[model samples]
Target: MTTDAETAVFEEHRPVLMGVAYRMLGRVADAEDVVQEAWLRWSAADRAGVREPPAYLVRITTRLAIDRLRQVKARGEAYVGPWLPEPYATDFGDTVPDTEERAVLADSVSLAVLVVLESLSPLERAVFVLREAFGYPYAEIATMLDRGEPAVRQLAGRARRHVDERRPRYDVDPAQRRDLTERFLAAAAEGDLAGLMDLLAPDVRLVGDSGGKAQAPLRILESADNVGRFLVAVGGKSVPDMSFRFLELNGGPAVLVLSGGMPDSVFQVDVSAGRISSVYVLRNPDKLRSLASA
Candidate 1:
């Protein structure tokens, strides 16, 4: 392929490469950096011997992400407060034709699952993303990671079990989730404690990620009463100029709170049995910068 053709090939496979990178490292900027590095490598590598561009590109992207993830772990940077994955816009558009596959992909990228994935070893995380999220067979995944099939399968099993045990199961209905989110936000904003309590499950949990840079509960809030009371009290004290809007984020509907036209925070709920089971709040200023552009 000529230079132009090679560039086109990389661009053609960019989406898949990006998807792999983002799944591997929950941060958007990190994912983009890894993908860019992959492109640099791809552009300079010997393409004459490359027969499968997609597989080769994915391998590069995944490996780059793994390296980056390890570096992040090694840095041991102390986050300001509860950390939340940067709210990502994950609209797959019309490219993903299968509903079931899309749901699986969405769940794999969810904040809950991503948090659990953080506990996993880098290699296990890679295997889980490739095998569970992308449905790559063990043999193919082994080739991508330069590991034996048995080893890949073992990683997959261990990762899957870890995630399953940690991630709170939730219903995956988009329509239902959207509706519940809308109602939950309305109740909170209006300081309707009764309404908010009604929407919350008895054992609903609230996880706030203000990273100590902002005002949020440093500890997780459990039970409908505690979560509901905290939200109502906080909602009552919100700035007079505060406002909110709904948008699809991280594969589901989310409420982006704004104060004087600036991003204040993000509120996303996980629903189970038609009630809000858990609420994820992203309030760290660093995490909200992308919202300005998003």
Candidate 2:
């Protein structure tokens, strides 16, 4: 039996645990599963000597996430078309008062960064999520992972280098991104190819994740002309009772397309040098399930 006080402690730390798990697994369902498992462990653990409940809970969550990640990697399941991380609904709200810290958290969970994180090893990903996103001290992270402090440092270094080299560097201004997203949405809705082209970089790439369950590009489409044309085509089609809503997803503005009041798709763009560098379209119904109520 879990005491109410113990339950309150678990609830207080749930957000951080969810953050760590989601970043590690790239799927909300998997992350929630890991968090639930962590809850079970936390409820049953012997806490007489546990001085830090937050750290203890985090350790259990991180370890569970790592094991789940390893299992997922070992399966090597072949996904249909390009796979993007499930769109995570984020609302930093008043919890993150510091602009700088808020930006860091948002950037870490961005679709662009999560895509890059998918390539890192399980341990490296764990280290990166804990150190970079949450700002955990190296010593603390080592204790959590049951690894030497020096080894944790090395993992963090390698993960940082790998992410820095591979992740797309996008402009981080929220206002700019939101403005462009609105403009982009307008252009697409009006079937304005030139308007769309004007906002896209010459080498802009569009990665659509439909899992072959919906209509999206089977392969990544590159070049402003190709991407612009595709958007125009998609925009021209009539979706019965279709509507759009702008929400902050993964720390930035995104367009959520709804058909008949149900989530149809999600669109987000990465901007660089004042032009749209990458456009992400997530149409997989499975991935959009959680966003239906948002």
Candidate 3:
């Protein structure tokens, strides 16, 4: 028999576990699976025998996430094109009861951080997430991973350095990001290559993922000129009646929908100092299935 207090504790910590799993695995579906497994372990525990419920649950969630990450890595190695993180339309106000905590969680869940996390190994990723993102102490992390303290420290250090090297400092204001996204969409919809060029950074790159199920740019295009040319071609080919709707994606603004009401693509805009740094286009039909289901 489960006590009311245990149930309350489970509800209290569910979001945190979800956040950790989401960051570690980069997929909402996988994260949900990890959390569900955590719940099973928690429910099966002998309440009188175990103590520190929150930590116990987190340990279970982290291990499960690490396992999932390994599986995802194998899939990515065989994947046809770029693999992007899953996007979620989070209503923070409704999901988080506390205003201050909600703000912190929202920042941690941003797309830039999640995308850069792709570079870390499964164990390194778990250690970094627990230490940096969740503020777990080295000793606690060691216990969770069943490793020595020195090993945990090494993993976290390597993970941190990798992230620092790959991801630029992201400090764009939300209002500015929204404005830039709107401008880009307007240019794209109108097939205004000149207008679009003005928004892209000099070294901007575009990566498209179609998973061989839909038409997409098979390879990554570097430099602003190539990206501009490709966008112009796509716009010219698209039907005149196509519409683009801006939605919250990976905690940033992104576009969805195309001509004849078909799901088109999901884009991640990297902004540096007010200009678009890069654009990641995810067109994989399997990846887009969630959007279709929604």
Candidate 4:
């Protein structure tokens, strides 16, 4: 029974709601479900006196995401092999024009930061996402979480500290990252062990997430020697009707490997001090499903 005008209003803020939900849950399906639930609530609610639609929608999405995160934790499902956030395709296009704002959004959604966020409590993560990623004021966040301003501020501070201590520092220049990624890909595809080692930092670490459904390292592979050898070995083998496409994933360049036009895996790297520092390989088919159409 929702009017067209009201539906239009909800659609206008859908992107922001999706951003908040995805940042909170780190899973596309969960985030989408939370957003859909928010739509259901908005459609059925009394909207006559609602003054700020964006804030209201965001609040519903955030709360739902927090509840979903808590339920997921309670389930205690075991994830096989090392886990990484599902690669999120980020094409800001014309939506984010300000360089500083774009950088903030990208950093918040980066794989490294998301991995660090997984260690934070759901409440802390919610506060951090709202205050850091979206720049919501302490009072506004307090109202959203039904928490006092001081309590919200404390949560933000604690979450910020934890993230600062654990998050790996990577070069933010996209050009540098893109160049390094291209060279790394070339070296890896060519099975050039020396070239791969040269582009990798001495202490480079590679984390592969296969969810036990694909062939990937069960344990994290570390050091240039180990990582280089693994890549070389992997490259030496032939994938049937394999193809590669470059896309912007998680706010950075990623190589999507497809076998027979279906997503096989995604490879993204973090650059530090002009060298590849961390390599993230996502082979989880469930996680790659979204990228299949990209």
Which portions of model 1 miss their true places by more than 4 Å? none
TM-score of each: 0.96, 0.99, 0.87, 0.99
RMSD of each: 1.4, 0.7, 2.9, 0.7
Tens digit per residue, CA lDDT, model 1, 16-37:
8888888888888899899999
* TM-score of candidate 2 versus the correct structure, residues matched by position: 0.99
Model 2 spans with C-alpha error above 4 angstroms: none
Question: In terms of lDDT, which candidate is strongest?
Answer: 2
- The CA root-mean-square deviation of candidate 2, after full C-alpha superposition on the true structure, stands at 0.7
* Model 1 pairs in collision: 80-211, 81-211, 81-212
lDDT order, best first, reads 2, 4, 1, 3
Structure candidate 4, residue pairs in collision: none
1-294 per-residue lDDT for model 3 (tens digits): 667888889989998888889889877888989999998888888867767888888999999999988887888666666656777655565765765555455555666677788878989989988987778999999999999999999999999888878765654566787888888877876789899999998888887878777778888788988998888887777554676677776666778865556666776677887888878788776676667644
| Cα lDDT, model 2, residue 117 | 98
Candidate 2, 212-294: lDDT as tens digits: 99999999999999999999999999999999999989989999999999999999999999989999999999999999899
Query: Backbone clash tally for model 2?
Result: 0
Q: What is the Cα-based lDDT of residue 138 in candidate 2?
A: 100
Q: How many backbone clashes does candidate 3 have?
A: 0
Tens-digit per-residue lDDT, 107-168, candidate 4: 99999999999999999999999999999999999999999999999999999999999998
